[model samples]
Target: MQETGVKLSREIVTALVEDATAAPSMHNAQPWKFLFRPSDSVFQVYADLDRAMPHADPTTRALHLGCAAALFNLRVAAAHAGWEPVTRLLPDPADPRLLAEVALAGATAPENDLAPLYPAIHRRHTSRQPFTDEEIPRAVKDALSGAALIEGARLVFPDAWHVQTVLDLVGDAEGRDATEPAAAEELRNWTRVGAGAADAARDGVPDYAFGPRGRHGSAPVRDFAGQQSVPGRGTAVFEGTPQLAVLGTPGDRPKDWLRAGQAMERVLLQATLDGLATSLTSQALERPELRWTVRDPQSAMGFAQMVLRLGYGPSGPGTPRRPVDEVLDIE
Candidate 1:
């Protein structure tokens, strides 16, 4: 390997890690760790098992997705900082928790196509609010699809029938959660409530980020508040026909899930750059049976990884993230 001698300054690494931690996770768990090896000039991404939600994400698939999103962000940040990031996913089979390793090297030009996405890393947020009925331009959709294809995944904008079926499945998942108290409990534990906690705490979804109650709409937005009512949380009517996209990979293994996550983030950042607000609803995909049903048999997409809502809406408030020092270790 040609040594590029890229100086991984502490300030630069901290900025990269900060962008990495901004990735949205299942319930804002942010279940990931970063280790920087100055000697080898490599950054290792690991799954934080302690932060994993066993009840909701039994297979740890969601955890892998979160870590991979962070990995994708790190690559973009590196490229923006004028370094080329060479990433290897699942670099060690013996250490399953180690999701990825990225080596940063000095670059004469921007690394790959990630430099354009650096600004989106900070701009993109999971907008839970209702979107307008305005359609996303075909050109923008094609670009988003291309972003996924570049990352070795497929992005499918389901037909009307398929969209309806996905919405029903999400409703079914919500119903199941209502009956099974344990499922909702797990989500509640990760949510930060009250002004003080939302302002001071790091990690997890804050109360302010929980958009208004779904008074009338079939959009698969998860009711983070659940049955608990926020004192002044108003109600709003969401778009009847939401612009939805399903991200998938050819396989359903852990590595495949990570790929889907990378694709998801890439598509999201591209969308952000193109002036689109997005939110994710994995409610239907959370359950194995529902996950399979959520897939469109007509489409070539294999395994559904995430359901994304994209449109012209208010960009969501930025959620809290743990300090870089807390999630990243230098050696």
Candidate 2:
């Protein structure tokens, strides 16, 4: 694994790509492709436009977020595998879909700070189940915030009133989705229900990962089973006072979204390592007006990129991911 002259081994390259694909995406679309240039030990990330949800994510902000998350994972994986990843976001402005290019340089030391988060990479899941009402410790919260800062973003735990407001906005988005045929169609297109689809398909949110219907709670979890009724899906009461955190960046461009996405995965991995279950709700941020309102004027966080729900609950089952071979191209 020499950084200057030698190409990365096939096994190591495969492992890095596998860890990258494990990142969470909107509806588990896994809208990312990786190209490994063995000649220069460079790994490129590209967005798969075919998998983009045009109706729900018109500007492709969510797509960039997903790809950036994978980019963060690649960095972590490289560190854990004894390489220092030098990443360049949007390396080519002409190709908007080319999100990032990571050049792996062999590290003198095998262990790095990101090595500790390597284990949590596989452990982190989007838990939709209800979390207990217990509050997160201040120290743990601070650590999560630090993780976001390292990735060039801010993570803020809003006050109760702000949390309530964001929850209300989420509810409004959900209500709009119920009547918005385009939104419903977009969700259905990315969600897999039957056993065949859930087990066989490599991407999309499966029926099992949808969690139970929100019988009573204000957790702001997205209900993937919009109108279609599943046979065994039961209703459950979620946490009333969910510990919500907003991740934001100073700007609202493609580069900002990419940084926010990296910050997001860093925070999530850190939280997972700290024994907290987490889920995301970008519903409010999906709408233009609502996205603006989600930002706290009193805080330094400029534009809210994501709303995170954190608490004590099940870690969630693993969702399906595309195989490394399908997503990676080696030259």
> Best lDDT goes to which candidate?
2
Q: Number of clashes in every candidate structure? A: 0, 0
Per-residue accuracy of model 1 over 1-331 as CA lDDT, tens digit each: 3455666789988988998988889998989999998877899999999998877789999999989999999988988887888889999999999999999866726327889888899889999899999999888899899999999999989889999999999999989888888888898898877888788868889989999998998888988898776767889999999989999999999999899999999999999999999999898888998899988898888899999999998999999889899999999
Count: clashes, candidate 1: 0
Candidate 2 residue runs with Cα over 4 Å from true position = 1-3, 108-111
- Each prediction's whole-model lDDT (CA): 0.89, 0.90
Model 1 CA deviation exceeding 4 Å by range: 1-4, 108-111
User: Against the hidden reference, what TM-scores do the models get?
Assistant: 0.97, 0.97
The residue pairs that clash in candidate 1, if any, are none
Q: State the displacement of the C-alpha of residue 72, model 1, in Å, after optimal TM-score superposition.
A: 0.3
Q: How accurate is candidate 2 locally (lDDT)?
A: 0.90
